[model samples]
Structures are given as structure tokens and as C-alpha cells.
Target: MRPLTEEETRIFFEKLVKYIGENIKILIDRPDGPYCFRLNKERVFYVSEEIMKKAGNVARENLVSLGTCMGKFTKSKKFRLHVTALDYLAPYAQGKMWLKPSAEQQFLYGHNVMKSGLGRISESVDRYQGVILYSMNDLPLGFGTAAKSTSDCRHSDPGTIVCFHQSDIGEYIRSEDTLT
Candidate 1:
């Protein structure tokens, strides 16, 4: 792990901020030594310190975080809401996709939602971008990667529209101590 210089943090943040919007209250808690980007100091993203520092300039950078980790730290690490970083910019979020009740079940089960499953979405969203998946009631379900462009996701026939959820509120109790 390394630390992010002020410059690396700026570039990394600029790209993501566009998806979220300039108004979202994101702060770099500590870009160096275990990178932490926080939304209002509550929801936090823990990505690698090195990756944050090394990138001179990268666009549409995947907001990968601790949840994306797949090793021993998986259990100990908390699920970070990389997508919800744009929640504050909900009004301006271009990559939002809402699902029907049936689709919500599949999404929570770690299945990709096909285009038909999408009940609503924003048109400005691009392909392979981070998107927020919402329940029928408009409650944020979690975040995912767009499998197709927003236009394609809307009318591109039956196919995966959103990637498997990367992080959700449910993850708080998962891979760790549970009510059980």
C-alpha cells in the first residue's frame, strides 16, 4: 500500500465526481496509507492507497473498493458503497437504473439484471459506468457496473443490463457477525 499525493487524489476524484456530480460532499479522508474517500464522513470507500497514487490521470476509473477484494481480508473488511457516492447527486446522476420487484430479488441474489428487468433509467449514462440500482420504491438497492450503454440498457432486448451488485446495505451483516 502507498499514499496518494494531492495530485493523484484530484485526478481520481475528478472522474468519479463527474458521475456523481460536483455537488456531492466527497472528501478524501486519507488518500495516503490506506486510501479512504468518504461521503459526508459516514459512507466510506477503502481502495488501495497505491492505485490512488500511481494513476497520473485515468478516466471512468472503476470505483473499486474494499468490497471488491476477494481474499482473507474479505471477512474483516466492510462493504463500501462505491455507487452511492452519487446518491447525493441523485437528481443529476446519469447512471441510475431502477428495477421491478422481481428483478430486485435477482439483483440481491448476486445476479445481473437484464435490460427487461429495468423499470427506469437515466439516458445520459454511458456503457461500463458505475450505476446505482434502485428498488421499485426508489430506495437505493446498491451499485453496479452498466453492462451496456443507457440507451442499450433501455432497448437492447433481453440481456444483462447491470453488473452484479458490488455493494449494498445488506452487506453490512453479511461476511461477518449476523443475527444468527
Candidate 2:
């Protein structure tokens, strides 16, 4: 992968910080390796439609791709955050454990956003869609935090414990007898 331009780096950092603050999770199923993020949603909803839009712009302007495949390949592409509570806490305070995203990954991310918009216009059926928050349960870890994931192995990754389906109400629901 090529080096990220200054702006790409800046946007990447912003995204990382925002997700971390919002407890938003990011999942990437890449050829190299699958990754997941458990973010902190303590202060506020850092990511907004506007931010997503900007991210879209950044991808187009910089020629970055968010994911390997764009919405063109699929219909009604969904964008959602899957939440899960950990029996053991994340390694934030532990330090070093937190990983920085590479330039290619960030580029691919920007592409995902752009594809969402194109998806709306590209298909007559509006097949390319947006993110879908699934299976959210319980409050954020800290007073102002949320959580997200990046799953690849599938087995090792935790399934949805919480979700952001209702952005306005911040609704969280339990799955069967899982959380109790």
C-alpha cells in the first residue's frame, strides 16, 4: 500500500478518535487480516451523517476505497454498528495494544461511504443502502462511551451484544437469554 497523504492521515486519526469516543465499532474483512474495534462512546455521538459525507468526499477526492467491494456489487448495502459487552474490558488503559489503521484500510473506508451514495442513484431498486445497527444491549461502558467490532475469524469475534439501530433513542435490547 502507498503512504497516506497528510489529509488521509488526518482523517484516519479523526475517524479513529471519533469512533473511540463514540464506542462505535469498525469491522474489516480484508485479504490481509480481519480486524475489529471496540470503541468508547462516552461523550457524544461523534459520527454524524455529515461526517460520513465528508468521509465519502475524502475517499473520492483522494481515490481511497473503504472496502474491497463497493455497493455496486450488492444491493442495499447496510451500514450498522454491532455492539457487544466484554467479560474482560478492552485494552485502552493498557496502551500499545491499540492499533493504528494503515493507509490502504483508510482509503478503502472512504470508498465505502462514496459507494453508499452512488448505490442510491446507481440502482433503480435502491439496492445499495446504508449501515444497520444490530442487537444492541445495555448502556455504554463509560458514562460517555459506546462499543464496536471488526470481525473476521468469526469464531473468535463476539457477536452482537448491543446495537445502534435507533440512533435517536439509543435503544438497547437483549438477545434471548444471553445478557439476562
Candidate 3:
């Protein structure tokens, strides 16, 4: 694995900033020890410095992966954040949505969240903004983009889509064969 180039870092951070906002600083300067992002076979990995050091000794050709796979850079150079990055994004997410128990299953099945399934939403959420979805009990389930602003949601019909499905934890099982 190798460090991301300046252009790659900018593209990656732009996508990440949409979900985590300025909390990117906290990720870079964490109290738990230094961490870094490395690229291997187009996949970005978030690894602790200690592990990174050990990984450095491995031949690049033989190092299949190292650290958490944050996401991958598509052939078009666009970065796509993976569900594997959900744990890091959840804590720093700027917009959050909570689903009702009844709707939890629907979302896990890869359906967009409908107004009827929404239990609560952050006041600052805006149309098309990135949002982290959680259960009513506060379990982070996935991440998606808001389909409507907070104000718009209040007046929308129950069947209206509130959040567009992107990646979710359920994919871990449902698409296990396809995931890297």
C-alpha cells in the first residue's frame, strides 16, 4: 500500500466531508494514536500507525489488504465510501435519521426510507445531504442521502421517500460474495 497522492486525497476528503463534516480533523488527530489512509488496488484503508508500520514490511504484491477498507476509487476517480467506513462516519455525521422498528426491516432490505418509517431526524438535515441512519435505539444501520429537507418532510405524504438508500450493514450478508 502507498499513501494517497494530493489529488487523490482531495477527492477522497470531498466525499468524506459530505458525511462527517469538519470532524475529519478529529479522525486525523485522534487521541488513540496516529492513523493514516493508504491505497492498495484502488481501495482506501484506514489503519493505525502501528499496524501501518508492520504492513510496510510486507511486499506490496503479497499484501492483499491492510486496515479497514474505507472505500474504493472508481475507474473514473470518484470515491465511493463503503459500509465498512460506517463506524467511523457515524460518530461524526452531521445529519442523522432514526427509523421506526417497523421500517427497520424494510431499510435493511435495501429500500429507501419512507416518511412513514422515520422516527426522528436531525433538525439541520437538508435536501440531498448525506445522512447516517440509525435505529430508534441508536444503532447505526447505514448511510444515505436525504431526499427531503426537515421542513419538507413534515409536510410530505407518508409514502414519500425521505432518505435514498446507499450502503447498509445488511449488505455484509446479502452481498457477501461480491464485497471486497
TM-scores, all candidates, are 0.56, 0.19, 0.95
Which one is best on lDDT? 3
| Tens digit of per-residue lDDT, candidate 3, span 60-172 | 88887778889999999999988889989999999999999999999999999999999999997989999999999999999999999999999999999999999999999
Clash numbers, per candidate: 0, 41, 0
Model 1 C-alpha lDDT per residue in residues 1-180, reported as the tens digit of each score: 223345544555555554565534443343344544322112234345555444323432333333122111123333333333434434445578888887887777667778778888877777777677788788887677777776666557766555556655455445344211
Q: Give candidate 1's error at residue 176 in angstroms.
A: 3.7
The models' CA-based lDDT, in order, is: 0.55, 0.23, 0.93
Q: What is the lDDT of residue 77 in candidate 3?
A: 98
| lDDT, candidate 2, 52-132, per-residue tens | 344444533353332221111012322222222221113221111111122122222221112111111111111211222
- lDDT for 120 (candidate 1): 82
Please list the residue runs of candidate 1 whose C-alpha ends up more than 4 Å from where it truly belongs after superposition. 1-4, 11-15, 25-92, 177-180
Q: Which residue segments of model 2 deviate by more than 4 Å?
A: 21-90, 93-180
Output the better candidate (1/2) by TM-score.
1
- Model 1 lDDT, residue 134, Cα: 85
Segments of candidate 3 deviating more than 4 angstroms: none
Q: Better model by lDDT, 2 or 3?
A: 3
